[model samples]
Target: MASLSFFIPALGKEPESIEDKIQLAEELKATDFNRFNELLKQVEDSSVNLTAEQHEQFRFLDAYRLAYSGSQTQAVANLTELVKVAKSEKVQFKSLSVLLNILIISRDYSEVFQYLEQYDQMQKNITDKDLRQHALGILALVFNQTSQFDIGYFYANKLSSDAVDGKYACFGMQFKLESLHRLKKYDEFDQEFDAGVATCEAAKQPIYSKIIQSYRVERLLEVDPNQAISLLNSLYQDVEQTSYNVLITLYKTLYSIAYLRNEQLDVAKEYGLSATKNIKEDDINYAILLLYSTLYEIEKANGNFEKALTYHEVLVSKQKAYDDEKAAGLLAYNIAKANVEVKNQRIALLDKDNELLSLQKDLYEKEARQNRLLVLILGAILLLATVLAYRGLTGRSRFKKIAEYDQLTGISNRYHFNNQAKIALDYCETNAKPVALILFDLDYFKDINDTHGHAVGDWALRAVVKTCRNFMRNNDVFGRIGGEEFAVVLPGCQTDKAVLLAEICRDAIAGIDTTESGKHFSLSASFGVSGSDNSGYQLKQLLADADSAMYSAKAAGRNQVATFSE
Candidate 1:
């Protein structure tokens, strides 16, 4: 909370006190680059001095601004400076995460791997709860993207089990599902695939759930190509209900499968052209290539041999770009070297500071003599060592707790929830008191994401979580098990009371807004309540019963609650 202005460069005079400077930075007009650059120039020309921590924060914000402004390459250059000065695990981890994501978007895979290797080291050093968990999630995703399924699944499960928040746990579950699919463990895949689908649906993440379903088609195709086509056709209407971008990709894929089946030629032509038209030339993902490939087939079918040949060449060229091993490894060295340069710069700065202090002592403290100077230098070194040691101890404790809670929503994760709930349930059972469980799932969340986009969907999720916390007290335990699906354990509470609470939450969520930036939409959730009598409490049974009840609420109409009945 201290003023962070020491980080900003001053203008002509000493910059405003740290608080004013930071407040001014926060108030900058986000869209007006002219005003933004004017503020930056004033800082760059400022006369103010800065602490190392302040300077690091300033530089991090600066690079982030550049990335936000779409100057990604320059952002990378700016971020490189921060990396060089990276003494703080939190700062370095944050910077590396941003840089890696930008590189991924730029398809700078070579450098992504290099930074990833460094990221592994940073994640280990991180004790900050928020940063550590976020790093774990990012690490899992990056590894999954790069085809490291085993390692990906490990981190995914770690994030899911360790963090109980919705989005983060959902991502972990999604990664686990993908990793399992890649490993070809069909039995495990089948078991998790449904959960994955449910989470995605509960969370209103249609695209991800559809991808999970698509894997089943891939597996089906491996066994029977014709049947696979039939399978996709059966799901056509559902797939078409997705957002335009996702629907385009699905349609293109379906066109290819239909072509294989030697059926739906007209349908293929319709979808191919529709997908191709919707796609811009700059879109270079695999889906775009498939669209072109499909176009090649459609064109050939129409006797447009020349056009078909042209499309074929384009498709091959796009495919070859991916096969270009040389390109993938191109930037790995320079980007990795950037990490090393950071350590080198840190050492250089320390050496330079020490040299300056020694000179200053010689020039100004001659009367104080060499003995005093010697003690001064030695004392400073010892003090620095002491501070580092203290930080190390404190940081580890924070990191350990970070591992037990979801970073996104700040709730107990599945792992922690299980422990806490068991204790609570046992206490209730021993006292012969009834206990209740409430499970809530956001209704049609995917539509919010598909229509309003992910940011709004996220806002809705946080709103629901926050609302749940407001309605429940300290005695209750809440955790997010599936995406968009949350559970609360109310020890010594009966079904009637649980149902009342669930309805309260349901109505509260229904009143919340979806979007955050400007335009807004309403959101709602379905709730299910189940209870255990004086006999005992079993979490698994409660969850299953609650899920079914919740499903009934969803069927009857969302934004309502259903209680388990005999």
Candidate 2:
């Protein structure tokens, strides 16, 4: 089957000419499913008399095509082998693009970094601005995915700054805005996105124009939902006339915004369904899951609890699958961190142990000398014994305190929270009582630090923590999860009561007078509240729901509270 498929392409094969190979590759990409398998077989055949370099290059292109067609796992495997062979064969940038695309598609971030190093070396031998710009864009995407926003911004800014005209500027600026968004630099996000939109419009880049418009719609939904809805309504009409991926993405975005607004659920559902219907089955899993989750929320809001629960179950299952993958990644990261920490601890402990041994040896020599002198042998022995006892006592006490207390806030950290929360959850579950999780975030915290100093920001954070502590019960658990975010676990609190308490906490922070540099100002927060029966509950799920609700509150407007249900 593979031979037959390759035979057709081989009849017209022109391995000597890159253009012919590129054209033929495109033709192979457009081939039907039955023919695709044949093309793959043909590409794998070794009887085509291709040189080693040509075979390696063809394999890279084949893997790239597979990646584009959504065979991600297979594509990654193929690309890994191709990269090995290409490096050995010293393949150039023309072949490098294929590997780059595979890296981006599979999100092989660490490998992408390694490839960037190779790219630097390869660039010294090639001179193609367009190709270089494309590679830079892909690199920016890799950085974005890996949460390296500053690096992504640096490369993206470079691309835009070096563009002769505004031709590639929009692409670069789009990435810049994305980096800013990820970094939580909302001010820069607004500025860059606006500039990108204007440049794309002036350059008549329709695809980018649509993308910027869609982004604007998304941004408007956060700041002003009514305005976003109006903008999306206009775009929806314009987009309905065309069949494009951007249009599908716009539909999904519009549906999500509308759902969050709690306006026009039926319309949102219709849009979501239509969007997925138009996409290929293999390409629509995430989109479908997202849409169905939105639908579930709408159903719950409308009092269709049974239907909502069904959708929620599906979403939970899907989320579990995603979480499993995330957990694996996190496990790898944690293992690396643990290994480094253990290595350092071992070195420190070894030094301390060796120092103690040396001290004992010195004392033993002194005792021997005293015995020889026949005077103070017993005194030296007593002093050495006292020193050892003191060291043992101090080490145990320090270790115990370190295990119980957080280093930063001097409060109970995640360890304490986990133990206490588990106990509380178990009590609530046994009594069939309610449990609430409240997640709160400081608004405009980055701006506060940029305007006031980091010291002032620290002062503000300490103030917020103090204020929050005043409202907590003796049994409640409060902990900082690092960086301007905090969590509170309330046992036996219902949804309405939890929401009310969250608002009170928000208002308390708002009322606090934080004076920095003799300028008195108040800060506000957004809250997400989730309450559950506590039975068969997962703490992580509660956190996730609370986070989603908090984002909803932020989307609605900051300085507010939102409750999660279903």
Candidate 1 lDDT over residue span 297-408, tens digit each: 7788778999999999989887777556334543344334544654576677689899999999887777567567667768888789999998998899789778787766
Residue lDDT tens for model 2, 249-347? 556746665656857777666666566466553342344466667768777877899988987887777777655544443433333343345456667
Alpha-carbon shift of residue 333 in model 1 (angstroms):
11
Which one is best on TM-score?
Answer: 1
Alpha-carbon lDDT, every model: 0.72, 0.67
lDDT of 1 at 199: 77
TM-score attained by model 2: 0.46
Backbone clashes, candidate 1: 6
Q: Residue 497 of candidate 2: its Cα lDDT? A: 67
In angstroms, give how far residue 68 of model 2 lies from its true place.
6.3
**Ten-residue segment with the worst summed lDDT in candidate 1?**
1-10
Query: Tell me, what's the RMSD of every candidate?
Result: 27.4, 19.8
